[model samples]
Target: ESNRIESINQSIQKKQGVAGCHYFSESVISPNFNVRITLNPDRERKCSRAVLRLAQQFPGDAGAMAPFFLNYLLIAPGESFFMAANEPHAYVAGEIIECMACSDNVVRAGLTPKFKDVNNLVDMLTYSMGGPNIDGGAYSMDNADVIRYSPPCPEFEVMILTVEPGKQSTFKNPGVPVIMIILEGSGAFDGKLCRPGRSYYWPANTDDLIFTVDSSKRGALKVAMAHKNLHLDRPTAINREDFGGASSSNHLNYPTSPRLPYMGLGGGSTPVNEDRRILSVGSKDYAEQGLPSL
Candidate 1:
């Protein structure tokens, strides 16, 4: 965790200009070892919770998990541990999809990024380790290349559309924002082409989202998407909304994740990218707001 947190510190403090304090001391490194990554301001910072990633109250406190409406992070085959809002994840080797509230309030117990407040993170994280995996029960799409993976989170859900070469999947969902992360082969979000490492955020109230693979590559064009369940008018209808609204009639009421195992490589694993260092980007604001920043 120290190494992981060190990487994040480098990125935020050194790489990016976000973190104001210079946390390059040995005490910060030693105490943060093996702790999950979750950093929030001590109420002295200036920011709104709607736009912030409040890591202070993480998985430990389910009541505090709502404000994070950050990006749907995609950790490729060799990508390092995702930071900020996303936490308690499940990704083992292959590509995976992760979507959560927009805020960067991540609650970590173990994984990467060693924060000084491990006790605080553990106190805020969700005690019950949900499932072992990300989205569960992915069905075959019209195109064999695409498969959708959905996790069972009420506030947000993820859909991984794995597309093969020359194949495309059309999603007609309106009013909700969608984030796409290209994992495997090269593809496009809506119409813009995205490489493996690129991440794109589609604005809310959109009516359509289309993903396509070049069809030249042999692997599937893995696309991970995160969006609000606007199609679901009621709580009981969650199991019935799938593959955009056009195909809602055939939506399967299958129970998603929160029951699967937390899949991912164990600690002391090999770090993937050397050029892109990880850093503790701090927590998103956790203050009160009026509008829903989904």
Candidate 2:
């Protein structure tokens, strides 16, 4: 969790910017809120009751009293929630397909057994009173049975495809790489059977990837994918140095992780560096704002 929190700290401190999304597979209660009140000696105990009962006010197990002063979000099935870099959010319940930039710069304040960095999480949060409107994030395509999630950050984009029986979905790579996974139903991709829970990765500009569901099947094929944002007008050629730097911390999510610029993803693990370096950049401000003149 330190590594996760460190990345978030770096982002909030302007060392790097990171963003992420959660595509719910099942209903759940998660963290996606901001402190609703000013903190004082007794105020923390008298804030909202949601997080108190949901996490605290019971025993030492639920979590902490901090969430009570923050706004909570309820994400339903088929909902994809986007969280920008440096935002304070926590997962409460339910299942979700979470995808973020290839970075673990996160800060975990409370809500889990993992080590909690109260000061860091508190200092990192924006403390904005309200959050995104229901329509703030997410959209779908009219022609194709697909929903695409394009968050505000520059790292990545996501797409959900629902391919009905006998129908096929064709994906043409304009120029970036793509990582895909089968979420439900059986289908054919690149002439091979694609089953649920299986993952597939295709380097940038690979032969047009195609998938189809047979007419005999009763269920439609559902697939979730993430790739470099296709909306940018940048050149196709990728410069390794553009990756900024490497991550010294790694977890199960991507395991060896984003050190792609330094080593092939699956290559032998490299020793973790204590002082990972990157070019200087300002903190992420979703409001199109930057730091006030210093």
Considering every candidate listed, which one attains the maximal TM-score?
Answer: 2
- Estimate every model's Cα lDDT from 0 to 1: 0.34, 0.44
Model 1: residue 261 alpha-carbon error in angstroms: 11
Q: How do the residues 15-50 of candidate 1 rate in per-residue lDDT, one tens digit apiece? A: 121111112243443333213123433331122231
- Over 4 Å off in model 2, which ranges? 1-58, 61-63, 135-143, 232-294
lDDT of 2: 0.44
Highest lDDT scorer: 2
**lDDT, candidate 2, 1-294, per-residue tens:** 985585555445421111111121112223332232233233333323443453333234223333332233333345444444555444433445666655535445434445545445445544322222221223453436776655444567667778999999887654777778888899998999999899988787669778899999999898877776664343221222232233322210111123111100111111111112111111111111010000
Deviation in Å, model 1, residue 197 alpha carbon: 1.3
Q: What is the TM-score of each candidate against the true structure?
A: 0.41, 0.57
